[model samples]
Each structure stands twice: as structure tokens, then as C-alpha cells.
Target chain A: MIGVISYQTGNARSVLRALAAIGAPARLVASPDDCDDIDRFVLPGVGAADVTMKSLEEAGWPDYLRARVVEGGAPFLGVCVGLQVLLDHSAEGDVDGLGWLSGEVREFPSSELRVPQMGWNSVDVKSTHPLLAGVPSDSYFYFVNSYFATVGDDDLLATTEYGAPFAAVIGRDNIMATQFHVEKSGPAGLAVLTNFVNFGKAA
Target chain B: MLTTRLIACLDVVEGNVTKARRFEDNIVVGDVETVVAGLYQQQIDEVIFYDILASAQNRRIDLETVERVASRVFIPLTVGGGIKSLEDMHLVLDAGAEKISMDSMAVKNPELITQGANEFGRQCIVVSMQVKRVVPTAAIPSGYEVAINGARVFTGMDAVEWARKAEAMGAGEIVVNSIDQDGTHQGYDLTITKAITDAVRVPVIASGGAGTVAHIAAAVQEADVSAAIVSSILYSPRMEKLTTVAELKAELAHDYGIHVRPIVAA
Candidate 1:
């Protein structure tokens, strides 16, 4: 079963509906108890990093997600702010993140481009992974964010350019995330989620 | 590289997508869900639905329509009109809207903009301005006045100043809807649109006037807007030749040299 983490900050409903639309049934895992029988997990978020971090911390999600994704080696996916909170720190509210990944999130330089780079932009894949299997090269995904992750090249799976190239997709081991809204993006995005549910199945 | 966006603005009345000229004389176009789903299939960059009668009639926005559309359409959805408080914003967002647009309510209580932004990040709050070209005054130095209640009442706030203030107050995006050009189909009011876009750092969407592909191209090239909201030429029955989102994006890319999202072959 697929468990979509719901911390009252992310658009879990949309994510749930999107998953169902692609023939991948899922349920909202609001608490750790709801994570039972859930082999695959998805964290979908929108809003500030600080705010989302606060919600996750208050709801005791960090430890549960860490145990499930980091230690258990289950397939995981994060979207937008969901991707940011997995890093070590963020410049959004000068807040420390989950620290599962050795990286930091910084605001895009507003002098060169709009702060929240809204709308559709294509991603350039950096590595072959199951999460981006069917998604075509140069396929645009919906992005509405003011910050991007700066991670090591080992974990960087894809990069997209706004003012400059930023990490649009990241993956290490069983953990994967995208700075864009995979559920809200068009066909390309749906492909990512569909690939995610079937990530380790083929193996 | 980031591309300029082409947005579809649906003016909804009584749960049906309506086409109007200058915000009056509405004509029912089609069911809201079907039209929106079709636009999504055409690869429209984003979609904004304004509940035109919600505020005037003092009612809540149609969340059913929002839920229906957002469920089927996998793109950013922004809903405006009748959003007065943080609770209303929550309801809309819970209904699957990515952004909440405040117009007259923001003008009445400016704190609502900041409050919503504080609660649900600035990126989810969009301050929509109903602007009309008026005589330049000391108070309205931009030669444009902000209108409220669907352009029924004109506020003394300057359009350019409002755009800047909205940004300062944490509005992530601004929609400068020209009352004069709304449904007129002539084109966007570039004068005021350019003024507001220049005054604010946040993404400004040129709305209220969109007739042809050239009009949308002009908004992007001349005003330097982030997006252009097109309505009439896309699906209105009044139009002699209705265009698809794919055709418009193709024209802008091929002729005007404006970069848009590459079309995903069906």
C-alpha cells in the first residue's frame, strides 16, 4: 500500500486524487500508526519551509519518516517544500531541516528572476533512475517555489535552470524528491509518480 | 530556462463558465469542469477561476467545482472571489486550489493579505487588482484607479501603488485586471500593466484584455509580464475564430520568438 504523509501543510488531497487517477491507490497517513502495511511513501508539501518543518516536528513525522525511509530503505518521494525539509537547513526561515541529506536550501537570487519561479519549466535529467523512467527529456513540470536545494553531485538526479541551474530532482538510495509539484504538473509529472509506485517492483 | 506562461481565466457565474464584456452581459459558455479539463489537455500553463458572483451575492465560492477541476486537471489552480478570511483561504486550498486571489477584500482590509500569507506562505496568496484607467490625480498618480466588487465601485487606491504594497505585504503574485479592456478583446492595457509590473518584483499577470495571439505576445514583450490571462478568444461563442492553447503557444514561439512550454505530443 502507498502512504501519503499528511501534516496539514501539504496538498495531500490533490496528491491522493492524482495517485488514484494514475491507477495507483493511496491513502493519507496522517500519523505514524497509519503507516502500517505501507511499503511506499510520498510527502507532498506546499508553503514555507519553516512552516512545514514546524508542522512535521509538531506531528512527530520526522522520526517516523526517518525510520521508514532512511533506516528501512523504503521507496520515498518528496515534492516542493517536502523536498526542502529533507535537507540540513534552509534559508527560507533560517530553520534547520531533518538533516537526512547533507545539503541546504537557499533562496533563488531575486535580482535575476522572479522570487517564486512560477509556471512550467523543463528538467534535464542527470542520472537514470526508476522515478523518472517514462518522463521524457525536456518535459516541463509545474514549479512554484522561491528556493532550491544545493546538494552534492552524487544525490543530484536532475537540474533545471531559472536564473541559474538548481537541483530540481534529487535521489540517494531509496529516497527521492523533486522541487516541483509532481501532482500538479501535467503528464510528465504523473509519469514520475507512476514510476515511483512501481520503482522497486521491477527489481 | 523558465518560459512565459499562458493562463486561461474562467469567469464563473452560477457554477457555469461565463463570458462577459467589461464584466457585464454574461453568456454561458459551458460546464466549468469540462472546459477546464479540456484546457488542461491543451497544455495551458495555468488556470484561474474567479467566482464572479460570490462576493456580490455574499456567498462562499463553489468548492465543488474547484474540487472537480483540480481532481482531473494536473496543473496549478488558483481560485478568487469570496475569499475574506484565513478560513476561506483554507477552504479553497483544501478544495485543491494552489492559490487564493483577494481583490476587494484586500482593499478593504489590507491585513488580510499579510495574514493569509503568514498562514499559508506568500506563494499561495495572489492579490488581484481590478484597475480602470482614470484621470491622474495626486492620490492616483499612476493614472489608474483600483475597482472593487467586479468594477462596480472604484477605490481611490492607485493601481501601481497597490501592486507594490501587495508585494510588500507578502502577496506572491499580482493579477492586474484592466476593467476597461475586460472582454473588450482589443488587448491588454499595456500602459497600466507595464506600470504595475515595473512597480512590483513579484510575478504580475496581465489580465482583462486578450483577443489574439499578438495581444498576449505584446503583454509579454512590452509589459514584461510573467503571464497573460486569455479568455474570449479561446472558447467564447462570440468569437469568430476560437483558438486552442496549443495554437497560441505555437504562434508565440514561432513568430514572436517568445519561449513557451514545449507542447507534449498527445
Candidate 2:
């Protein structure tokens, strides 16, 4: 079963509903013990980086997630702040992230563009990955964020431009994440989630 | 590049979706669930629901309707009207809403914005303003005054100034609804819309008076707003002609060259 991590950060219900829409058997992982039956994991978040980290830490999710997904080789996905927490650190609240990927989350540089890039924006595919299997070219996804992840070239899966190009989608080994809201995004986003559900399963 | 967002605003009263002209003469359109389900199928970017009577009646928001509607909605859902405290925000958010918009409460208790932003993140807190056009005066330099209680009471505050304050107080977004243009189906009030958009750094949404696809295009082209909210154009049978979100987005892309999310076939 695919497990969607739930906490006080918000938007977990939307993610759960999206999984149900795709005919995927999923349940909310409210605690670390809920991780046992969850083969594929989806961490959906919508809040500040510091707040998301604190809630996850309070619930003892960081170590369990790192052990199961990062080291255990189970497929994992993160959305919005979920994606941010996977990085080494975030400038949002000068807080540390889960450090699953070697990167830092920083606010979009002072520019003419708005700070939190709220609304729909297109994603440019950087390379091939199972998570993007049925996602169309130039597909747009819902984005509501002030910070973007800066990852190494090898980990970049897709890029989108606000003021400057930032990592919109990143994947390394068994872990993948998107800076946009896959659940709120239209059909293209559902396509991404569908691929993620079938990603590591034996064909 | 970020595309312009087209949002559908559902003015709900009691338990059914309704429409009003200039925030009066309410007419029931359809049940909340069916109308929202149709909008979803049309690939609307976002949806906003305002409980029109909750605040005037002096009560909490209708969480039952919110929870029922949110169960089927996959896109971002923003709910406004009757949100009075942090507990109210929690109740609405827990009912599955992505964003909680504060109108009457925000103007009365500015701290609610900061509190909501601090607790739930600024992105989830939206400050919606009801502005009515008035003669230019020193007290109202922008020639527009903020209204509340379904636009029945004028707050004597300048629309542009209030927007700036809300943003400073940690409102992630602002929705400026023109009391005069609402339900008129003429067009958005561009002057005030542009002024507030210029005054704030966060995204501003132009609400009220969306008649045609061109009107929506003008809000982005002339006013430079990040998004536009429409009601009668999509749902009102009383309109001369009804349109779908797909048609609007297509016209926006084909005629106006406005970047909109491509509609995915159902």
C-alpha cells in the first residue's frame, strides 16, 4: 500500500484523496508505526520549512523515514515543503532539513517576481525518470512556494523558472520529490502520481 | 513561467450554491457538490467558497458543507466567510480546505492574520477585501473604501492601504472584490485592482465583474493581477450565454496569448 504521511502542516487530505482517485490503495501514516505496511511513501506538506520539520521531528518521522526509504530502498516522494525538508537545510527559518538529498533550500533571490510563486507554472523535464512516465511535455503544475531547492546536476529531474531556473523535480536513487502540489495540479499532476504508484512495482 | 490563474467563486447560502448581484438578490444555482464537480471537470485552476450568511448571522462557518465539498475536490480549495478565530481557521482547515480567507474578521482583528500565518503558514491565510468605489478624499486617498458584512457596511478604510497592511501582517494573498462590479457582468474594476497589485508584493486576485474572457485577460494585462475570480460566467444560467473553463482558457491562450494551464481531457 502507498502511505501518505500526515501531520499538522496541512494538505494531507488532498493528497489522500488524489491517491484514492488514481485507484491506489493508500492510508494516512499518522505515526512511525504506520510505516510498516507502507511500501511506497508519499510525504505531502504545505507550511513553512521550520514548522514542517518540527512537526515531523515531534512525531518521530525523520529517523523512521530515513531508515525505511533512504536506506531501505523503498520508493518515496515528497511535495512542496515535503520536498524542501528532503534537502540539507532551508533558509526559510534557518532550520535544518532531513538531509536525504545533498542540497539546500533557499528563497528565490530578490527579483521583480513575487516571493512565493503562487499559481500554475510549466515544468521542463530535465531527464527521464519513472516518476514522470506519463507526464506530458510542457505540463503545468500548481506551485505555491517562496523557496526553491538547489541540487547537484545529477539529481535534477525537472526545472521550472520563476525569476531563475530552480529544481522543480528531483530524484536520487529510491527517493523523488516535486516542489509543486501534485494533488492540486490537474491531469498532468495525476499522471505523475500514477507513475509514482507503479514506479518500483514488478512489471 | 507562472501562468495566470482562473478561479471560480461559489457564493453559498444555507447549504446550496447561490449567486448575487452586487451582493444582493440571492438566487440558488445548484447544489454545492454537483456544481463543484462540474467545475473540476472543466479543469478550473482553483475554487473559492464564501458562506454568504454565516458572518452576518453571527456564527461559525459551515464545516459540514466544506467537508462534504472538499471530499470530492482535488484542486486547491479556499473557503472564506465567518472565519473569526484561530480555532475557526483550524476547523475549516481540518475540514479539508487548503486556504482560509478572512474578511470581516481580518479587518476587525488584524492579529488573526499574523496568528494564522505564524501557525499555519502565511500561504494558507488569505485576506479578502470588499471594496466600493467612492469619491477621492484625503481619508480615502485611493477613492475606494473597504466594505464588510456582505458589503452592507463600509469600513472607511482605503482599499489600497488596507491591502498593504494585510500583506505586511503576513497575509499570503489578497482577494479584492469590487462591490459595484460584482454580479454586474460588466468587467473588473481595474483602477483599484491595479493600485492594490502595485502596492503589495504578494499575489493579488481580482474578484467580481467578469463578463467575458477578455475581461479576465484585461485584469492580467492591464491590472497585472496574478489571478481573476469568476462566478456568473461559468455557472449562472441567467447569463446571456454560459461558458466553460475550457473555453475561457482556450480563448485566453489563442486570442490574448495569456499562459493558462492546458485543459486535460476527461
Candidate 3:
């Protein structure tokens, strides 16, 4: 059974529905105890960085999730604000993150481009990853966020254009994340979720 | 590399999908779910559902329609119409709406925009304006008049200036609908659209006059707006040949070099 982390954020139900669409059985797990017997885990969020951190702490899932992914070596996938929380810190709030990856989240510089970058945007693949298996180099995914994670060169798997190139996808061993919403994305997005499930099965 | 967007607006009344010309003559279309599901297979970028009956009754947003559509459609969903208070906004957002648009309420209480932005973030709140172009008289200059509640309330405010105020109050986006061109299909009101687009920094969605594919292109290219929201032409059975969003996007991509992805079939 695949476990999808259910914190006080958006896109949990949509993520579960997407996994189900790909013939995967996924359940919403609020706490680490609920994820004891699950095979892999998925973290989903769609809100401010500060609020998400508060929710994770309130629910007491951060330490549990970190152990599962770091010590237990369980495969993990994150989306939107979920991806940002994996970094060391976020400028959205003055709070520390999971520190799973070496990076920090910062607000996109305001210009003619709108904040949140809401709508479909293209992704440029950087390296080979199973989670990005069938997705095209120019494939577009639905995005809705105000801040983006700035990962190191080694951790970047894909980059997308807005005002500047930002990390669109990141991965390191059993951990993976995407700044875009695969559930809302069309065929290309479903393929990403399918690929992640396939990776979970292989692990 | 900004691309034009094609949107379809569904007016929901009493849990039924309906369309009105001047906000008076109502005609029932197909089932709201079926039409939405069908539109999801086209080249449409996003879908907006206006709950026309909910606000007048002073009730919360209709979660049934939101859940039914969100269950099947994977694209972005925006809910509007009768979103007066913060509680109303939360109900729709919790029900799976990506954005909540406010019209009469925003005009009545401008602080609602700031309150919503502070709570849910600005990106989720969209301020909608119904504009009518008025000729320059001795007292007022040649500008756009703002209307609300299906044009029932005339605020006598200029559309451009009101857009600036809405932005200052933390509106993430603006939807400018042309009352004069609505359903006429002559084309969008370019003068008013350009004014608002120039006055605001956020994304502007142009609505109200879309009869043909060319009209959509003109609204996007000429008015320099971010998205063009259409209803009658895209939903009318009489124009079945031109109803499909894929065909419209293809024509745009081929004719004007605008790349738009066709919505995948369910």
C-alpha cells in the first residue's frame, strides 16, 4: 500500500485520485503511525511555507516523515510547497525546513510576470530520473506557487522558465519532488505519477 | 513567451448549467457535469463556474457542483458568484476550487480583498468587474463604468481606476467582462480591456465578447490581455463546427504561432 501524507494543505485528494487513476492503491496518512505498513510515501501541499510547517509540527509528522525517508530509506515524492519544505529554509517564512536537500526557498522576483505563476508551464529536463521517464523535455505541467526552491547543480533534475530558470524537479536516491502539480497536469503529468509509482514498486 | 488562454464560463443556477444573454433570458444547456467533462477534452486552459443562485439566497457556495466537477476534471477550477464573506471563500476553496472570484461583495466592501489575501493568500482571490463604455459627457470623461450583480448596481467608477484600487487591495488577478459586447459576439471591448490591463500589474482575464476564433485571438493579441474567457460561442450548438477548443487552438497555433496544448480525452 502507498501512503500519501495528508497535512493541512491542498492537492492531497487530487494526488490520491491521480495515483488511483494509474491503478495504484493509495491512502491518506495523517501521522507517521498511520504510515507504518505503507510501502512508499507522498508529501503534498499547496499553501504558505510558514503555515505548512506549523501544520506538520502540529500533526507531529515531520520527525516521523524524516525518519521514514532518511533512515528507513523509503521512497518519497513531494509536490509544490511540499518540495519547498524539503529545503533547508524558505524566505516565505523565517522557519527551518526538513533539510533533506541542500537549498533554500525564495520568492520569485516581481516583474511583468505575475506572482504564483499560476497555469501551465514547460519543464526542461536536466538529467535522467525514473520519475521523469516518459515526460517530454518540453512537456508542460500546471503550476501554482509564489516561491521556488533553489537547489544545487547536483540535485537539479529539471528546470522550468518563468522570469528565470528555477528547479522544476529534484531527486536524490529514494527522494523526489516536483514544483508543479502532476495531478492537474494533462497526460504528461499522469505519466510522472505513474513513473513514481513504478519506482516505488521497484524499490 | 506568454501564450493566449481560452476559457469557458458556466453559469450555474439551481444546480443546473445555464447561459444568459443579458443576465435575464436564461437557457438551459446540457448537464453541467457532462458539458464540463466534454470541455476538459478540448484545448481550454481553465474553467470558471459562476453560482448565480447561491449568493441571492444568502447561502454558502454550492459544494455539490464543485466536488462533481473536481472529481473528473484535472485542470484548474475557479468558482465565482455570491462569494461575499471569508467563510464563503473558505467553503469553495475547501471543496477543491483553485480560485474564488468576487464581484458585488468586493465592490461593497473593498477590505474583503485585503482580508482574503491575508488569510488565503492573494493568488486565490480574483476580483471581477463588469464594464460598460460610456461616451464622454460634459461631467465625466470618456471612460468605462463599473457594474455589479448582473449590472444591477452601477458604482459610477471608472474601470481603469477601480482596477488599480483592486490591485492595491491585494487582488491576485482581475477578470474584466464587457457588458456591451456580451453575447453580441462582435468582439471584446478592446478600449476598456487595454485600459484595465495597462492599469494593473497582475494577470487580466478578458471576458464578454467572443463569437469566433478570430475574436479570441484579437482579444489576446490586441488587448494584450493574459486570457480570453468565452461562453456563448464555445457552448452554442448552432456553432458546433467551431465549438471544439482543440480546433480553435490549432487554428491559433497554425495561424498566429501561439502554442496551446489540447486537453486530453478522459
In order, how many clashes per candidate? 0, 0, 0
Q: Write the per-residue lDDT of candidate 2 for residues B49-101, one digit (tens) a residue.
A: 99988988889889999988877777889998988888888889878788999
Write the residue-wise lDDT of candidate 1 on A1-203 in tens digits. Answer: 89988876578888898898999978988888777789988989888899999898888888988898899999999989989988999999999999888798998888877878988888999888778776666889889998889889988989999888888999887899999999988888888998888888855
Q: Candidate 1, residue A87: CA error in Å? A: 1.0
lDDT of 3 at B154: 82
TM-score of 2: 0.97
In Å, residue B228's CA in model 1 sits off its true spot by: 0.5
Error of 1 at B111 (Å): 1.1
Point out where model 2 deviates above 4 Å.
Answer: none
Cα lDDT computed for each candidate against the true fold: 0.89, 0.90, 0.81
Question: B-chain TM-score, every candidate?
Answer: 0.98, 0.99, 0.93
| Stretches of model 3 off by over 4 angstroms after superposition | B135-142, B237-241, B262-266
**Top model number, TM-score:** 1
Model 1 chain A: weakest 10-residue lDDT segment is A128-137
The residue-by-residue lDDT of candidate 3 on A109-147, one tens digit each, is 766566657678888998888889867687778887788
Scoring the B chain of model 2 against the true B chain gives a TM-score of 0.99
The C-alpha interface RMSD of every prediction is 0.9, 1.4, 2.1
- Output DockQ, candidate 3: 0.44
DockQ of the candidate models in sequence: 0.82, 0.67, 0.44
